[model samples]
Target chain A: MRKSIAIDMDNVIVDIETNWINWYEKEFGVKIEREELLGKPEDEAFPDPAAALSLIYKTGFFRHAPIIEGAQEALLKLQEHYDIFIVSAAMEFPNSLPEKYDWLNEHFPFISWKNIVFCGDKRIIDTDYLIDDHLKNLDFCKGTPILFTASHNVNVTKHKRVNNWNEALALLGLH
Target chain B: MRKSIAIDMDNVIVDIETNWINWYEKEFGVKIEREELLGKPEDEAFPDPAAALSLIYKTGFFRHAPIIEGAQEALLKLQEHYDIFIVSAAMEFPNSLPEKYDWLNEHFPFISWKNIVFCGDKRIIDTDYLIDDHLKNLDFCKGTPILFTASHNVNVTKHKRVNNWNEALALLGLH
Candidate 1:
């Protein structure tokens, strides 16, 4: 059987930072620089954290997130070598469930519904490898953990790191 | 740390059979007896399988499914001993995602969103025990499988069986 890899949806494949930042700027009428967000979580990066984080509760926030550059091509190549499951922690925002499903359907049509998981705790997931941006998830994972680079997780060095989709493909020997 | 248990939604905690049967009777003007549905899957149990199954796609089908008898009490008791996760194969019906979350919130209020998982495949779940009505889920489970009795699965005997919530509690050594 091919080894299975659980890939996180947010910062790993979907460029949620860009979408969230744009929404934050549009709603708050402030164009925050990327440097301000570096080394800090999304909530803490903003002057008013709760107000900025509230944008996630908006209906189309998750659905409209831009796909990471080269994610589609990298994922297609990864699919040939491994069983890929797009795992997202969407239970916290119940509204994001269907939106995430539609987003995946529209963008990654190659991934079947059977391979998508909207879950709460990633610790319950058992796979050969887990690719994620959160150290909390990787700390408890039973499989090999590959840290996907995100502004919030730049300082975390406990797991193998991949700076981008290209680096991920290279690390996994896909290219 | 507590040993974790993964519990199925349909036919286990939420009685989908009664809801679907009631829906079919209302739509087709023909009542389906419980005996007729015995030993048969939901779709195959009906005359027009497609039409009957289509009710699942209807807006509020999953949202209104009645909770199983003694489930709330038994689950509450079980929660004290084991980490309980409500795992459901909900990705197939994208519309059912939020509805199922609402249903669980209304009926099983004690279960936090942190313990709920909506996914395509049960094989990815890692827990100490899985209480489910389907054998396909059990077949791939890496943990102990406890088969919950359902009309369609009465003939299945490959796993340890519990006829009702009372039996399930007794088998688990709970009062």
Candidate 2:
């Protein structure tokens, strides 16, 4: 049995637009400045892309996206074999870890206030299996590495990748 | 079965004191001038702690930390179920990720090339779990957090913590 399982919430479990809206509003005051979204340049996407990227995990944008399709089922099932945890890098600190934990608790019984780790580095959160959407994370991860795919990952053409939960399960032989 | 794992080298899996000594002489001007190891000030680990940190990761100081007891065994067993990755935060450039990978490969097969993530925040590495001596990193994780014990961590007194492979396994119920 897998001892532990970790799931990424955004993109893998939640949509992207949720965070984009929040970032736009908070960083650039773009909610009142809606025209900024219609970019002559992508500056409004992240008012300061470089700084935003560095602080992305600490941003208010996390916890905003809706869980991806089938992520709930996969996470719930994975919980049966592994101690489950949500390893995420959010620039935003929720009012409390319990707030996010409670939100997740509504869906999955195995996930709880104790298992949740909210930090800038998802790697520090220990688990046997960490499902993530970002490729760079896989660079040093040991185990069955699963990549949640997206349009931006197009350039990552090779190197054994996956787009969804079904593919990830099959790839890992969990299917 | 665990599918993903994250490991830390310096001060986590191995001791880097001597290695740092070698680096001090080579990169910086004089040894005692380096100061920190000689019991200098809090921030003066070197002429530039950032430079020292960068050189260590770059020049193999990180690759040479004598393996902590049970480190090899713990990592090997964890690898059976998880895709292990090295999510490290070094101040170095392109050398950060690859150098860490090399150190792992040279020292332990458990930490192979396929799984290694070199980054600064680590929270951004996007793993389900990350291991580090920094309680701050432990405090900042976004998942099922595991705080591995170190000499300095003894004073950290509270919060869920672990000392070695056995304790870590117990934390995840793998033991």
Candidate 3:
């Protein structure tokens, strides 16, 4: 069986969180409170964090997101070996799942929409490389977690911190 | 027979002109002469429009391009009836085509590198609905040319203008 890879859409595929944070915060009437969202346990993070993720995604903020530095190059290298699955927790919220799916279809056509899984909790899904930024979701990975660095992560430094797609590839030993 | 629709990438798929105007004025010391670029014949309006387009596309400008307002809804709807080809004159220039294609893949996965048609003059390709912003390329299509609206083209009333995608659907009768 081939190793499957789970990649996050927001901060990893593109810089959605950083760029849309201000606009979304203004519109939603609440702060993202990155530390709190990432620090909470998965059970507590549910509904609120997922709600926040879906809320931001519903505003159509990720439509024009800039791809993370070296994202395409990194994905290209990764695609050669592993089964690239863009399993996004971004669109798991209600009312906008289909819209987010359409958006995903527009951005990345290489993976069939079938491979693009959406769920509130990522730990339930199994994959080889879980490339994501949130700490709450990283705990359930049966495989190694490739941590994507962001502005709002806690001080737990056990996992690999990748600055860009290039660093991600290097950490995966694909470079 | 499938009616091939060869659309432009820069403005057709995403708004590349507005993004470049800002870059050109600051870096190249050239204010965007839109009237000069679109109105006059390509030879007269843009003595080196091809070169200029190549320069902008190479700068990774396509990575952040907003899908042209009408083109987005229009392209998705259009994808159903015809074999849509992204025939961009911008990527025909040297050293920029690969990155430009990659950029398209990042934003609009519906358009793969293989389906994209590159030409100095779109007149060479065969297509029905040539949804384009540039007037020069419109000459290539024997079918109806659905004009995507833009800032520089506020005054050109000769061609049909579409600000939203639904109007594009109506124009192509894809609705």
CA lDDT of B90 in candidate 2? Answer: 40
Q: Which candidate wins on DockQ?
A: 1
Which lDDT value does model 3 have at B105?
Answer: 66
Candidate number with the higher DockQ (1 or 3): 1
C-alpha RMSD of each candidate structure in angstroms:
0.9, 15.1, 14.9
lDDT values of the candidates? 0.92, 0.56, 0.61
Estimate, for each residue in A1-175, the C-alpha lDDT of model 1 and write its tens digit: 8999999999988999888779988999988777788889766988789988899999899999999999999999999999999989999899889899999998899999889999998899999999999988999999999999999888886899999999999988888
Error of 2 at B95 (Å): 4.2
Q: In terms of lDDT, which candidate is strongest?
A: 1
Candidate 3 local Cα displacement, residue A117, angstroms: 0.4
Clashing pairs in 1: none
Regions more than 4 Å wrong, model 2:
A1-175, B1-3, B21-58, B91-98
Interface RMSD of each: 0.6, 13.0, 17.9
What are the per-residue Cα lDDT tens digits for candidate 3 across A1-175? 5687888877788676554555546656666555554655433543355555554545456555566778777777788888777765542333334444556556665665445654445544456778888877777675688888765554568687887887888887788
Which digits, one per residue and each the tens of the lDDT, describe model 2 over residues B77-157?
Answer: 777667776655542233333344455666675454335443344543445676777765667766556777654465565
Q: Write the per-residue lDDT of candidate 2 for residues A1-175, one digit (tens) a residue.
A: 4566566665666655445556646666655333443322223345566654543445234434456677778766666666666664431332323334444556555565445444444434445666776666554455445667754453465456777878876765666
Candidate 3 residues lying further than 4 Å off, grouped into runs, are A22-58, B1-175
Error of 1 at A78 (Å): 0.7
